[model samples]
Target: MPKMKSHSGTKKRFRRTGTGKLMRGKAFKSHILTKKSTKRKRGFRQETVISNADKRVVSTRLAGR
Candidate 1:
């Protein structure tokens, strides 16, 4: 059987946690941040787990990793 390739885009955007959850970065921090408060911007620095609804789909894309 042929080897399954992980989704390149998803692979770059998400990471596997120690417990196997998918960790991803928050959005809206890349552009025009002058109006956004420092507190909100700081929150974006931390990683977040993917939603339960998307877990299965993302896991499949992540393959072995």
Candidate 2:
């Protein structure tokens, strides 16, 4: 049987933590920073766990990893 390949885009966007949870970057911090508050911008710097609904899908894409 051929080896299963992981999703390239998913691998770049998500990472597994020490405990195995998938961590992803918060969105909306990439452009038009002038209108966003400092607090909101600061929050975007932290990585957040994928939601329960999306966990299965994301993990499957990352199965080969």
lDDT of 2 at 40: 99
Per-residue lDDT for 1-65 in model 1, tens only? Answer: 77888999988999998887899999999999999999999999999999999999998888944
Tens digits of per-residue lDDT for model 2 on 1-65?
Answer: 89999999999999999999999999999999999999999999999999999999899999974
Clash pairs, candidate 1, are: none
| C-alpha local distance difference test of each model | 0.91, 0.95
The lDDT, on a scale of 0 to 1, for candidate 1 is 0.91
TM-score of 2: 0.94
The prediction achieving the highest lDDT against the true structure is: 2
Identify the leading candidate in terms of TM-score.
2
